[model samples]
Every structure is written in C-alpha cells, then in structure tokens.
Target: MPQSVDRALDVLDAVAASDGPVPAKALARRLGCGLSTVYELLGTLTARGHLVRTPAGYVLGYRVPSLHLAFQRQMRMSGEVQELLHRTRRAAGVDTYFSTYRDGGIAVLAAATASHPATGGFTVGQDTTGHATAHGKVLLAALPRAARLRYLAASGMRAITPHTITSPERLDVQLRRVRHEGVAVEVEECAPGVACVAVPVPAAGAPTAVSAALPLEEFHRRGHQVAEALRQVAAEAATFQGTADISGSTGG
Candidate 1:
C-alpha cells in the first residue's frame, strides 16, 4: 500500500481508539511519525471529511458514519435470521450476539438486545480476545489446531478481566471442552459482572457462533436455559436461506 494512504488510516485508527478528540502531537507520538507528516495526513483526511478538526483536536467526521452505515447494510441479516436472534433474546432474557470468524478475527455480525437497556454496549466490529469471550471461544474452537495457535499468537491473550484465561495451556483445555460439548461458557471473563454462553451455528458457509450475555448471577442461575435457547436459535438460523457469512479464510 501507498505510504500516504497507510498513514492516513493509522491516524483514523488512533483517533477512533482515543477516548475523546486528540491533538496532532499525540497522534504523531502514537503513530511514531513526524509532526509535519501527521499534519499533512490530518489536513488531507480533514478535507476528505474522514476527520474533523475540533477546538480540542481531531475526531472522526461525518464520512465515517456513512461508511459505518454502508458496512451495516452490507452485513445486514435476513428477516429470518433477525427473527431468530430476537427469539433467542426473548427466550433467554438477555442480549444476544451473532458472530463469525472473519479476516483472522471474531466479527460480531449482528446483535439483538433487550427492549430496555442492557449492561454492556455491543460494538459491531472485530473482537480481539478469542481467549476471553464465549463467542470468541466458539469461533476459535472451530479452527484447526495450527490455525488456532497462529491466531492466538497474533492476538495475545490479554486479561480483560481478572477471570480471563491468560495461559495458553488453560485456554487450550477450555477450547477442547467447547468442541466436545458444542458450547462455550464464560463467567465474568470479558467484563467484570457479565457472563455469556455461546453455541456454534452449524451453517454451511461461514463458521458462526450465537451467544447470550447477562449478569453473572443470572447466568449461574439459568445458564443451561440460556445455552439451550442459543443452540435452538442457531439451529434455526442455519436453515435460513440468506444467513449472513461474515467470514474469511481461516488461514494461519
């Protein structure tokens, strides 16, 4: 790729990762590029409406939303699949997620939340912690051993929460259990008080996982019920004609 385009994307990523608007100097330091180069890229991106110059610093601009919306449209689930997700959410009484192994990472394709506010907000993008999330575990369990190891090596097992499995040996044991039992469960691994259960979607195309997330106490009390609900919905979703395949090659 061209150096200019690469640097522009890096700037965008840096801004998006930041908590609020960030100045050019911070961006330069983060990207390890010169101040002048950062300014040039920022000017170009600002003119293209990909970044906006704010009083504080720079933030993503209006063009970003359009791109996000376009991506959502392209990955939108069919009515049948959407209905199945909602059904799982209703039955389990928790926020539901549908995900797949895509482009060497876990991508949350769609989600169905409760009518009222749920605990954690779902970010529709690549998820890095395959060792921590139930859905991530499900997707990782589907990969061949070598490919799985490569993914793990690339995406380190960071401890998101205290309960997260940071050891490769421990994660391997759990993944084996997921493959044998055909379900993955995590207790407060991804977040402080959240627990999730996931099951593989036995669809023909992309390797997919459907999961339900709820409070830790509720999960312990009704874990079996939620896991069953997710499995049922995943099975139903597999039969749908246009279940989205948001996956790429599972190569090492």
Candidate 2:
C-alpha cells in the first residue's frame, strides 16, 4: 500500500479508538509522523468526508455510517439473525454480540444492547484481543490446531487485564475446554468489571459464536441464565439460511 494511504488509515483508526474527538497534534504524536504530514492527511480525509473537524478536534464524518451500513449488508446478517441477537440481549439481560473468525481475525458482525449497556469495548471490525474475549475464544477453539497456533503466534496474547491468560499454554488448555464443552467463559479478562459467556453458532458455515456480556457480579449471579440464553440464540441462528453466508468470502 502507498505510504499516504497507510497513514490516512492509521489516522482513522486512531480517531476511532479514541474516547472523543482527537486533536491534530495528538494524531501526529500517535502516528509518529510530522505535524505537516498529519495535517495534510487530515485535510484530505476531511475533504473526502471521511473525517469531520470539530471545535474540540476530529471525529468520523457522515460517510462512515454509509460504510457501516454497506458492511452490514455485505455481511448478509439477516433480519432473523439480528432479531435473535436482540432477543438474546433481552432474555440474557446483557449486551449481546455475534462474531466470527475469518482470515485469521475475529470480527464482530452484530451487537444488541439495552439502553443501559454492560459491555463497553466491543466495536465492529477486526478485534485483536482474541486471547481475552469469550467470543474470540469460541472462534479460536474451532480452528485446526496448527492454524490456531499460527494465529496465536501472529497475534500475541497481550494481557488486557490482570485476569487475562497471556501464556499460550494456558490459553490452549482453555481452548481445549471450549472445544470440548462448546462454550467459552471469561471473567474480567477483556475489560474490568465485565464478564462474558459465549457458545458456538452451529451450522453457520464458519467459526461463529454468539456471546453475552454483563457486569462481573451480575454475571456470577446469573451466569447460568445468560449462557442458556446465548445457547438458545445460537441454535436459532443456526437454522437461518442467510447465516450460511455470514462469513461471506472470508476464509475461516
């Protein structure tokens, strides 16, 4: 890829990852590039309507929503599957996510959350912290042993929290358990105060998983209920013909 395009993408990623609008100086610092180069990229992106400048700084522009809608359409997430996710959120009383492993990465295809959401970190796109997320664990557990090892080698097990299992050996043990039980659970691994439970979405023609996240204390209190709800949703999603194409052309 061209250096200019690469820098532009890095700028977009940095802004998306930020909690709020990011100043141009901060973007330059984050990208380890000169102020002039960053400003040039920002100006082009803003003119293209990919980024919008605010009094505070820059945020994603109007074009992003259309891109997101196009992405959702390309994913082929049917109404039935989306409804199932929403139903799981209501039944499980937690934020729900639908995800799949493709091209050696995990992507969250859909999510349903209540007015007061529980999980805070999940976003659409490639999720890099597979080692610390239940949805990622379920997808990782489905890979062939060699492929799984290769993916782990490429995406190091960075510890997101103290409870995260950073050691590959330890993670392998958990993956084996996930494969055997067809479920994955993580407590305060992905984020502080958050616990997640996930189950494989059978017959989805990809390494797909449906997960629910809630407060750690609430998870402990109603973990079994949440897991059961996720299983039910996964089973229903498996029956949707549209789900067969959810992975699209992306290889598992």
lDDT of each: 0.83, 0.85
Tens-digit lDDT string for candidate 1 (1-252) = 498889999999899877789999999999999999999999999999999999999999999988866765565456677677777667667899878786677788777886433444455678788789899999999988888888888899998888999998999899999999999999888888888899998963666888888898898898898888888888888877666454367875
Model 2: per-residue Cα lDDT over 69-146, one tens digit each: 787787776768778888777765788888988777788988888743337478767888888999999988988877
- Candidate 2, residue 154: Cα displacement in angstroms equals 1.2
Model 1 TM-score on a 0 to 1 scale: 0.73
* TM-scores of all predicted structures: 0.73, 0.84
Model 1 gets an lDDT of: 0.83
Name the runs in model 2 displaced over 4 angstroms: 19-36, 54-56, 114-120, 248-252
Residue pair clashes in candidate 2: none
